[model samples]
Structures are given as C-alpha cells and as structure tokens.
Target: MTYTGDVQVGGPADVRELPALTICKLAVGPYDNNAYLLSCSETEESLLIDAAADSDRLLALMAERPAGAIVTTHQHGDHWQALEQVVKVTGAQVLAHPLDAPALPVPVDRTVEHGDTITFGAITLEVIHLRGHTPGSIALLYDGGPAGSHLFTGDSLFPGGVGNTWKDPERFTQLYTDVVERVFDRLPDETWVYPGHGKDTTLGVERPALPQWKTRGW
Candidate 1:
C-alpha cells in the first residue's frame, strides 16, 4: 500500500463517537521507521508509539499536544533511540512489556501484559502480545473507535511482511506463529491495522496471506 506522505501534523481523525485520535507519522532514520503520536482530542492527551530518531522533530510534535505517555512495541534501537528525550520533555511515564523492559534506556514506569487495558477518559486500549519481532513486542487495540478496532501494531507485523529476525532463527519462527495465531486470529475481520512502518491495512485483508507467508518459509 502507498502512504500519501505523512498524515498532516495535527490532522485529527475520529474513530467511533469518541474524540478523534490524531496520528502523526514521523519517518525517521535510514530505515524509515514510523514513530506514531496518538493524540486524544477529548482530553488532549498524547501517547507516543516508538520514538525512533530526529529528536527535534519528535519533541516538537509532542510539545504541540498534551503529551501523556510513551509506549514502546519492542526494544529495537531503530524504534526507540529518542525515547529518553521524549520522556524527559513530556515527563510522560514509559510503558512496555516486561521482557523488553531492560532494553529501555530508563526504567519502565508501567509493565503491560497481554490483557492489560489503558484508558484516556472514555477511550480504552486493549493490549495484545504479538511477540514476533521481539519477546515483548505488542499491539494496542482501540475498540471503541468509529473504525471498529484500531490496532497500533509495532514492528511485530507490517504491510507486506513481518519484522526482520535474522539473528535468531528459532525465536523468529515462534514470533511469526504467535502473530499469525494470537494477533491476526483474535481480531475481527474489520480491524484496522496501523503498523510501525508503511501504509495501513485491515485484518481481513492480511488474514488470507498468513498461510502463504507460512508456506514461503521466511
């Protein structure tokens, strides 16, 4: 899928009847990792997903909203290099899975599990452990959205592929299976998947490719 540049900074898109969650996609580093800023219109609270790089621009976007917290999908440096700066500037608590907690630059304020829930006023986010790219990789599901369910899928799954795991063959396969069964299988067909990089797609659209992915033997 093709992304039409970055979603305009401050452009708010409402899901469900809840306040719009404005997402700003920051394309950073040589890998072009996507760091997302989830801003809640009702409370003006903002939560960042992956900090990546380009500290100045990332902080600038955070400063524009009521920065709330920083939630990482995993511990990969490409997705978390600017984390410390983001935390310091916003004084936002850092949340991550316990397994990836140590890889963080600072102590994690909150350790989230598979069934954990995060709420901002009326909106609630359900945590799903996708665990393929890394042991602690997770996906955040916003169920009350106008878009049905909105998934903030970190590096665990992407548009055309899953995250790279050339270092550990066994763990990589395990992660892939967890994502296919745990993440994709659990969601409804209409769920909107907002990945860490590339354009957005639905669970219904990507579900059919699972068998093909397994067959190819990545």
Candidate 2:
C-alpha cells in the first residue's frame, strides 16, 4: 500500500500496523512539521525526533514513557522550534551531528556521527549523516527491529525527490551520493521511509528515481 500523510500512527485505533515498535506521529506548529515518538513496547523506553513545535502537544505524548533522548535531525529553525521546551521538561539528552550542533537552541549532549548506533531499549538505530539539505542532516535506519526495517529520514529522502538544497548543485550532489550509497543501495527495498514532513515511501519505489533525481538536479 502507498504511504499517505493522513496515515497517522499516533493513538490506539491506528496502532495495528506495528505494536512492537510503536511510532506515534504528530504534525505541529505553523509549518505542520512532523514530530515522532518512537517507543519500545518491551521496555517503555522512547526516543523523540525533531521536537519541532507545539511543546505542550509533544509533552503530552511523552506522558506515559519519558524519552531518554531527543534527537535533532538538523539545525533548521523550523525543525527545532520546540526543542528547548521539550528538553526542559523531559531532560532528554540532546543529540545532533557535531557540525549542526552549533545551530541548535542548546548544547548537544551527545554528538552523533555516521555509522554511530543509538540504543533505545532493545532496538539499535544506525545514524546516517547526510549532506545537502543541511551539512549535518541525519536519517535513522532500523534494521531487523521489532517492526522489521524502517527509516526515519529527517528532510533527506522524501516521496517525490530529495529535500531542497536551495539549488545548490554541490550540496545536492553530496546528498544524492549519501542517499544512494548509505541508504538505497545498502538497505533492502522493504525499508519504509518516514520523512520529516508529509507522506512516506518505500525504498523500492524511490530507488528507481535516483537516476532521474540526479539528471534533473533537484
């Protein structure tokens, strides 16, 4: 089935997809940015992604299980509007790529790099440091986890094309190379991609568009 932005996974009714690796999605703030709460059913441990906006809403989502860490995908202001508030309440370790850490609202408690792995209960998420969208944009890939293979791409790879590089050909090239080598080429086609905003897509569908993306230069 195709992934749509309306296909939400937050509450009980829509929890049928994967209960083991529970993913709660929230679209908040003016830009309607996507924020995710990834929780491990076994340990009740969770990780927060983006913390984009609407601090109250994000805090409510973390009521049951406190997040051990809040990972910032990049340094963009839109993606981190509510970060400071969330951290103040949850006391989650702020994680970001060293290069992007300076742009964040607060100091990055933990610096994540390419190939680094983060543990949230039983699952270990691999960090992919992607360039182009932002120098230190990152995506999280879960291999053989409870929900099988899944990808959390924070403004990197999306349904139609890669994230905007502001027409910077050089940055686009770097992002393209990183996506092909680190993601599509390495991961299985079944890997589900949950983007930072809007809909999600499978690697199998996006894999065929790599050439077009390069040629067209988005």
Worst 10 residues of 1 by lDDT: 8-17
* Residues 35-66, model 2: lDDT tens digits: 88888878889999899988888898889978
- What TM-score does model 2 achieve against the real structure? 0.92
What are the RMSD figures for all models against the true structure?
3.7, 2.7
**lDDT at residue 42 of model 2 (Cα atoms):** 82
Candidate 1 residue pairs that clash: 15-146, 16-145, 16-146, 132-175
The whole-model C-alpha lDDT of candidate 2 against the native structure comes to 0.85
lDDT of 1 by residue, 59-104 (tens): 8767767457888888888778888987887788889999999999
User: What is candidate 2's CA lDDT for residue 54?
Assistant: 83
How much lDDT does each candidate structure score? 0.75, 0.85
Top-scoring candidate (TM-score): 2
